[model samples]
Target: MIRKLTKDDQELLMALLRKEPALNLFIIGDVENFGFEQDFMDLWGEIDPADGRIKAVLLRFYRSYLPYADGPFDVEGFAEIIRKDNDIHMISGASEVVKAFDGEINFKQVKQLFFAELKEMNNKISESFSSAEPIKKATVQDVEAICALTDTIEEFESSRNGSRTSLRKTLESNTGRTYYIEREDKVIVTASTSAENSMSAMIVGVATHQAFREQSLASRVMAQLCADLLHEGKSLCLFYDNPHAGVIYKRLGFQDIGSWTIVNM
Candidate 1:
């Protein structure tokens, strides 16, 4: 049976989420900080009637759906939920699970991404970055400039706790790491990590301006970011749909763990 999650279920949720924290990073972080009452969350779970325990977890929020199922789940039931909601912008999950649901519905586009992770550099990577300027961790003062790079600020602000204000709050947190390259007070290249903890982190938001594309700026920032994370004993992970991006990451020592599929409906 699928039902809504309540605050009282936190301990149970954490146990399952911690089992694969990297894939469930965003879900874990959000629920840890806030409970089920957050505006962006439409959290649900599939409970096993036989065992009286949750077998699968689903989060529907921020125009996307993320599902994690280690045991049996109601795939058709969950797909029906997506079928009813007109707001689903993307569906992301373990490749097999996402593909199973994708086959049940028609989406405008589907992206099969490589979910890669790195615990150590395969070889010597330059500790030095030859950029136009030094790349460093972003502070709260640089939040606006960073937000300017993404064209989806309005949607982000509408998505509860994903606003520019939320970005500021994340930067305020010690675990939230956003790095970038700035030129004349404007950010041209950037990389960021979300759902950070002592054990692992999810690396996202790696971008570079069109004009700065060939300068290896993204690599510089990413290498620095991954190096920093691995140095602190955190396994860094990312999802990439672009082969070119994958090539860059492979050179930097990331190995393909599996695929993360995203379907847009």
Candidate 2:
């Protein structure tokens, strides 16, 4: 009985999301598109009404979401959903569900890296670069500098959609946080972290000026940001596209949790 998530369902969805904040954030931003057809409800699943109590619920975008009260969920139903829709992939809390879809779904280990327990500082980049100034939150005046830094990042042109207006709107919102390393008259490096869930934050758009490379500026900025996040008792998650960057994050205390794969169906 899956159906489109209507405005009437907003309260129910928000309630469900309070229980799974990360998934809530992911879906709310693009409920209409969701990378598939067959309406929005085709992307969601709940325990059968006849099952007495609703034991589980799942939401599918291009990626799938499954949260359950019990340890294991209805994996077979999840598989059927994927098969019927031919959705590229799904993400879930239960490892068992992932394993159940192993043959039909391509699985990659996306590391949910964390720094929950801080260790003694060894080469604390922020500390090492004591002369470097503190990082600051970005504002509208910083838009040009931010766009330049984004340009420095190789993948931005090909992968990202939307205009500066859209980016500005997003940055103006409280949900996305952006930071910049200012020096003299310009911003040399920048990084931003979006809270994907109550417990998880995603670090994104870290870039530096070509002349600023090897000076530890990016590391120092990131170290300071990470320290602040750690102080607030939150964990950070980031995706590394290259082994070199993964090595860098590893030095900063991130572990390979798993991988995520996207397929166009």
Candidate 3:
């Protein structure tokens, strides 16, 4: 049976999600930040009648729907919830789970990206980046410079999906953080995290200035960011569509765990 979850279900919900914290980073973060009181967010769960335990979880945040299950789940049931919502904008989750909805949901456009997770730093890369330029944690004052740097990178132009206002809000809320390296008063490279909760964080907006692309500046910045998060006992995860970028992340001890799928409705 499936039912809309309430605050009373928090313990059960977290127990299931924390099983794979990296896979449920966004869901967990949203629950932690918004809880069950937000008008724009709601959660549903599929429970096994036999065990009275949750078998799958689904979250609707604003216009997006995110579903997760460690094994098999009622894809049709979850899809129906999304289908009934006239404001549905996107459906995203593990590629395997999302694929199960192919026949149930009429997808407008689908995008897939390699997903990787890091639990520990690569000792070799850690040692090398140790001598690199000191990285600084970004404040609200750095939002304009950070966005400006990403705007100049051709690779980031089409994929830059965030806004300056949102970036500043995130920094102010303490839900996310950004680390950057600056040269001559200009931001050259940056790495940032989003959907940060107690168990894990999602890496986003890792970019370097066009003139500094091949100089390992991005790697150094990422190393520092990842190290700091891991030190705090949070696992790190990221999605990348570029093979070259995947290679760099792998060198930092990230392993391909699975793929993430985003479907526009």
lDDT of each: 0.79, 0.56, 0.91
Q: Local error of candidate 1 at 24, Å?
A: 1.3
Q: Between candidates 2 and 3, name the one with more favorable lDDT.
A: 3
Sort by TM-score, best first. 3, 1, 2
TM-score of 2: 0.66
lDDT of 3: 0.91
Per-residue CA lDDT of candidate 1, range 1-265, in tens? 9888998777777777777767777777777666798787878888888876777888977788888888667999888887888777888888877877756778788778789888787556545555458887888988878878754423234443454676687778755789998888788988888778656888877778766778878888888888888898878789887788899888888888889888877
lDDT of 3 at 211: 81
lDDT tens digits, residue span 1-265, model 3: 8999989999999989999999999989988988998999999999989988888999999999999998988888998888899989999999999999999999999999999999989978867754656789999999999999888878766656666877898899888899999999899999999889999999998988878888888888889899999999999999999999999999999999999999998
Off by over 4 Å in 3: 130-132, 158-162
**TM-score to native of every candidate shown:** 0.76, 0.66, 0.96
Measured by TM-score, the strongest candidate is: 3
| Candidate 1 accuracy as lDDT | 0.79
| Evaluation by TM-score, superior candidate among 2 and 3 | 3
Report clash pairs, candidate 1: none
